[model samples]
Target: MLKIIIAEAELEPMPRSLRSLPVMKKKYGRKDVVLLDSNYHHTSMQTLPDAYRRGRPDIVHVCLLNALESPLNKDGGLEVYVHTRNDKVIYIDPSWKVPKSYNRFVGLMEQLFSTRRITAGDTELLRMVNKTLPDLITEVSSGMPVKVMHYEGAPYEPDPDEVLVIGGFPHGDFVSDLPFSRFSIHGEELVAWAVLNHVVYGAHGT
Candidate 1:
């Protein structure tokens, strides 16, 4: 049986989906998955010297945004870095540069933003306001005082399975922890939502 330990930056509480991995494995037949939690603070590092004192991990999966931003050196240990690309796909790379496909996605976003026919204020409103604006011109034509405002902005279509991970301390430090793992890291929210749906509906299914 392969022993796998997942270590993540202790930002927020462990996600429920990730917390349930051990149960899922036991119910199925994979008795090798283990979930571990760790923060990037100094206190967390103090616990590390004794956490894995007995033996090193077969696979040390680091679930962080930019692991290579500050390359890690784990003597003789196999380390993997995973991150979610701007397009929401999990990318496992040993270096800092994003893949060619991610670059293409960024290019597409840039083109879309450049061609957008709206001002910054309107764009911000489009995301903030949820209701359609009232027709002020009709009221003005009816001899009633009315104000007309043109909010030109494209509609926001967020991915359905998109999960926003917000983290903040009592002071002001904050971070958004994303899922980026080789074992399961791909697709947009559709993939994650599908996996959650499966876990919910097909828990008994092999």
Candidate 2:
């Protein structure tokens, strides 16, 4: 499996953030993958009844939409995560069915934000995850040695048991103290989606 961390993704519930879902879902939403939404800014989880009354961390909506449409999430299922800026982490059940139509999608998101969960009949989708990404790495590796995606260092050599970490922000360098290898797949910086597509394709070979 290819484990990817979309670190520092802005989850502001603005129009831009909401629109980002379709774009991200079109790209990184794939089978055999786990995309972690790390350090996203979102509405306070404790404020349940008024969740959407504020604004949700749209990255959760985007990532869940991506995973619901992923082809590789068929059998074993994909374990995806959302790490909020406030340090709260939740794992989304991959089998959660996302509404397909845009109107329904919006409504569904509202319900999820307000209730803090996803339910299709008896199934629950939003699960609070406890594992932390130390230095954004170290543990949760479980044989998948993590790699930092950069624009420098050696070329990216994809491995089945490796975790790929990429910045989801518009522009910024990673904070110091990344303990894994860093390599660039391009000479210059690419937009988040471009980089996302390139890296996943390189790793999954399709």
Candidate 3:
């Protein structure tokens, strides 16, 4: 029988669709599948030791949204098949070209200007930004402001909608109405644009 262990941080916060993995697995075959939510304990990795002793799973998959980029290490535990989604982490690699789904205006700004001096206003750019705003708001308010900084830069402001965006004045122009936003070349195109640009145009009721 194939046994799969799926580990993630918080099941409630994740979308119900994603949380239904165990139910989906039952449809395929008969196996011992465990979906573990880390929030039940103080430390997620701590649960692994006990879980391992109970039964060694055939395949272990960590499903946290940003597990790959997490500071925690998965090196010392039980030796078994381990797989993680690479999309969670964002790192710049010269060999890979930036995806084209990103806003052209925002992309140009990042390439031409430093992260500290970037902004966006195009229709598509706004749409992408709006999509990621709510998540950013929850993250920032949760005391993980550094995550917000990871996308943009230091110091951010959450708009009335609770969407966190870059907060600064552009080009040393104290009087200029233009707001300073930053964008990094990482993650999904839409999410990357929202974080780096410091603006969420479409996010409403968030």
Give Cα-based local distance difference scores for all models. Answer: 0.23, 0.52, 0.25
Q: By descending lDDT, how would the candidates be arranged? A: 2, 3, 1
Cα misplacement distance, residue 140 of candidate 2 (Å): 2.5
RMSD of each: 22.7, 10.9, 21.1
User: How far off is residue 205 in model 2, in Å?
Assistant: 5.9
Backbone clash pairs in model 2 (N, Cα, C under 3 Å; residues 3+ apart or in different chains), count: 1
* Clashes by residue pair, model 2: 31-72
Relative to the true structure, candidate 1 reaches a TM of 0.15
Clash pairs detected, candidate 1: none
127: Cα error in model 3, Å: 26
Per residue, candidate 1 scores C-alpha lDDT tens digits across 31-86 of 23222233222233343433322111111111222222222211111122111111
lDDT of 1: 0.23
lDDT computed for candidate 3: 0.25
Best by TM-score: 2
